[model samples]
Target: MSKKQEPGAAGRATIRDVASAAKTGKTSVSRYLNGEKHLLSDDLKERIGRAISLLDYQPSQMARSLKSGQTRLVGLILADITNPYSVEVMRGVEAACRQEGLTLLVCNTNNELDQEKHYLQLLSSYRVDGIVVNAVGMREAAISTLQQANLPMVLIDRKVADFACDVIALNNVEATQMMTDHLLQNGFEALLFVTEPATVNTRLDRLRTFLQRMQQSPQCIAEQGEIELSNSQGLETLLRDFVARHPDKHKAVMCVNGALTLQVARAMRRLDMTWGPDIGLSGFDELVWADLAGVGITTFKQPTYDMGVAAIGQLVMRIQGNTEPVKDIEFSGELIARASTAAR
Candidate 1:
């Protein structure tokens, strides 16, 4: 007894059926369907077109994509989407994705390694074409997982030196150096570099650059002052120490990012330190309060939007079979000098 055929089985035209109807090889039909139009002659193109129209064939995008091993979707894993940097980068990524006709999936890890790893695993399971990770610390396991899966990944605002992937970063070192130099040139001698932790690449690079630049001047070298804090409690402790230790010296502190800046502002209020005259300050990234904070903070303005745009562009390129080795793109951070760092 012969089994009955399914309703669409015989009616649906595969590449083989199209090729047979067009009097051409299956390879030619496959290539043409995949957008390799250059391989087909005018006559062959017409025959294939006629065959497809006659069969009323509708290609299964999912099946074709699976066969080609791609989904045309890019995933972005951010440390914290609340950060202005992350928000700006996301904007750029969305714009680029829209232009390329690709989809974007964003995941916020809140700076947790385990959460980041979980999101990475989820994105991989979804079979996304590529990923843009703005992660903290270097997790060899995470990098290895993505590499083993053959996913094209890019790092944004953070770098894992050992990981082989494109990086979209701000010129953290250069920007810090420039900000420190400006502080020095403006005659604010007592300098302190305050940051969250040295684990992330951006923080480490900024701290290193600030230290290196300050070392060039004998005054800063002699002081040897640096403050590293993890949370708001640590920030409070550091600020109290600063107030107690530098009662006489005019204080000029540099914060790594906006979160740090907010903490510093709160710390200043608690310590009763005046902004412009008594305590001079500058921050790495600008915040919503940078302008309105009791004392406006001078800050290094990163092109967060541009970084996002470039990251998406890179992911799209990788998806398009650009097998070129990974690259690191760095954008300059602008120094927006404000009242906080005004000279005495």
Candidate 2:
């Protein structure tokens, strides 16, 4: 049986059609589409432009990119774009790509390994020049397969275990230590570290550093709590239990990131607890809403946009043939103090 014509393909204008209309060869049309107009005379350029306009011809970027061996396209996969950190990072990547005259294919994994794997395969099929991922770290096997393809890749904010690649993230250890020290200096004897789960690299690093710092202090008591993000009631319950457990000491709740900080702050408000004398709160992420929270939340401000730009830079360097040793770039976080962590 004869196949039916696809909806748009029947009237689509091909390079041959454009060349015929322009009274030129297909090679010349292809060159024009690939931004080699300078190689052709002004008269030929005008002819091609007129033909393209007349025919409503849309050149296949993928086909031209394949022939040229550079798509000028980059894939970006984020764990969750709804997070402010992810949004800031994406802005940086987008700005850098615009400056470089490149296009970005952005995907949100939502921390689902299966979705991430699927997007990786899809992006690979598109033949992107490189990929920058703020991974959920659950699909290392699929990522391993991509690594074998030798596509230039950069891991942003999170890294896969044992999968060596270029990584750009905040200095988690130093940032956690700084927050820990701030709480201790503010006369918080008991510190409770709150997080969603220690599933990703950044979370694990911050949690481990917090634990280690608390242990080293000897004078300050340390406790850790994990909140199931899907359950809001559970978070409030967890905070209430934490406060009950540390009734004797001046306690501070240290959130793992901005999201957790907001969660914890809300829970505290719901429980009729205040930030100043009753309980102090501080965490990573210098979110905009942090200051508006009760007595202004103390926070660690990460260079999110810069980190995103830096991640793309590393990926571009690899795409441009940088084959040196794998490097992990860590940007430092600045601690912003406010009434939240004020000494009693």
Best by lDDT: 2
Candidate 1 lDDT over 101-138, as tens digits, reads 78899999888888887888899999999998898653
Model 2 segments more than 4 A misplaced = 1-58, 138-140
Q: Ten-residue segment with the worst summed lDDT in candidate 2? A: 1-10
lDDT of 1 at 311: 86
lDDT of 2 by residue, 4-100 (tens): 2222456787888778778999889878877788899999999888888877787788776867899899999999999999999999999999988
* Per-prediction TM-score: 0.80, 0.86
Pairs with steric clashes in candidate 1 = none
Q: Would you list the C-alpha lDDT of every candidate in the order shown?
A: 0.80, 0.87
Clashing pairs in 2: none
How big is the RMSD of model 2? 5.1
What's the lDDT for residue 174 in model 1?
Answer: 85
